[model samples]
Target: MTSFSPGRLGLRAKFAVIAVAALLLGGVAVGYTLRSTPEPSTGPAVTSDGPERRTTGPGGPRLMVLSNGVRSSVALRDPAGPREVSSQRCERVYAAADTVACLAPAGALEGPKLLVSDRHARARESVRLTGIPNRLRVSASGRMVSWTVFVGGDSYAGSSFSTRTGILDTEGGLRLDTLEDFRITREGKPYRAADANYWGVTFAADDNRFYATLSTDGHRYLVEGDLAARTVRTLADNVECPSLSPDGDRIAFKQAVDGDPAKGWRPAVLDLATLETSRLAEHRSMDDQPVWLDDRTIAYALQRPDGVNDVWSVPADGSGAARLLVPQANSPAPVA
Candidate 1:
């Protein structure tokens, strides 16, 4: 009788191989059942390092970007939604109902100007702001808004463009105060401005004090200016892009150590009293603006290597990692 070729398996061998495969698959299933980790417990509320300390509007807030210095924010019923808000071109601050601030050109700029807009990019007020007024700040009540109108066409702006910070009442009255050598606040604590290049003007929760970034002789610092006092004091050093907390106790800013605008920088937090500086996040890319969410978390605009700017958020306490809040964004503002 001819012998069976080695290439063909006998019935017994085939059965053995099948039996081994069955046993192996069964063992894998059993091992997976025994060794797999249990699913994490879900609860009514989850906590984290940052805003567990302050009152937050909604958990897992979503971001919306508009332009270089503008954004719109809305509630996140679901984080995975299409990022569609009920309104068109609203500012990012969502805490107050229908309250958001947009940065627009002040007017037909004979010189530099800042235009303040409502949540929907509608005109709120024009401050005749001159010089390079980049970032504008509005009060918690959204009543008062201010910004630095740098005057220097050249470098002498510290002396020449040294601006007179102005305040406007939506009801009617408009007042523009001269520089520090001469301030124009009738009362309210005697406020003074840092310098001409100083931008990022923001009002306090009480609508009393204002905060901003001042570039003096190329060194960047944070200043808390008292409108009533008519005086300005440097709060923190090596920092710019200052955004105050909703409560008005802490400040979120980007620190520039090299003192050169070309070198780039990182995001930081500073205690208003001690003037102590702490780094919240580092960026190989440019981090443009930061807005506070409940005084503990900061949301800002960041640009990646591919040149797509997006919104991002990280804890103020520096306990958590930097998370991308919006995948596509330019200037991100936190609402309410």
Candidate 2:
């Protein structure tokens, strides 16, 4: 894997690097391009007139999303209605419990950073990091936060891309800068590899146990990790961007079409105990991580050909059709 130093690259060089990487990665450009240009409002106009901007608290269920680049929220019951927009800008964001995690937009001469904030959107902590932001997640209890970034390549389907995934304990201040430092067990034996790349982490309710995608050699596997033990063991193959369901009995993940990344990915659900996989009804290729809106439904961002995104939801049991939940929004994080 090649190393990338974002701080050392100029703005033009950075874009050039990404453009070239995208072409080499089978013409699937980085997901950021889909969000670069702002699109027309699809529903009611967003407003900042509301006092319930906080992600979590004594309010009705709301869904946190990125309206263009700014942090915003919409009522879960009426997603097409007006929204409360915030001043904070993030490349990727997620909220759970009383905590919110944001991947601050990267600058030409600066690397991306992790910004931790409270439910009220107050900045609490910031950690400097490298690479372009790709994925971010906050544990259900809001105590653990994890993120993934692209260090070299752009798309997950390409072999040239290098990734760095990290975890931070908000309460204890324990940080794992890279999952590479943790021990890995593959096929019931000690595993070690220079090509190992971990990403798309989803934590269990306990926060001690987690699941993430481990790509090595040429295969992608879903691995169950123990935060306390600092170890991970392979559970299944061809699972990427695993998002644990609210009930914790299953995981919503993107599975490569026919076990091939060049073909794209399909949203699927895996029963943890039975290890059975059920493919969802949505046939379109979804590159974003699927977040569970509840135990019975899953939400994810789908990008159109012209660089526009909309949040879509599908039944977790593979029974219902996919429907647009929020238009002109990305990074759907349900906050109750």
lDDT of model 1 at position 246:
73
Collision count of model 1: 26
Over 51-160, each residue of candidate 2 has an lDDT whose tens digit, in order, gives 23444323478998988877788888888777677667789989999998989987878877999988765677899988889999999999999999999988987788
Encode model 1's per-residue lDDT on 161-187: one tens digit a residue: 443345544434544434244342222
| TM-score (C-alpha) between model 1 and the true structure | 0.62
TM-scores of the models, in the given order? 0.62, 0.85
Q: TM-score for model 2?
A: 0.85
Candidate 2: count of backbone clashes, pairs at least 3 residues apart or interchain: 0
| Predicted model with the maximum TM-score | 2
Superposed model 2: Cα runs more than 4 Å off:
1-40, 44-59
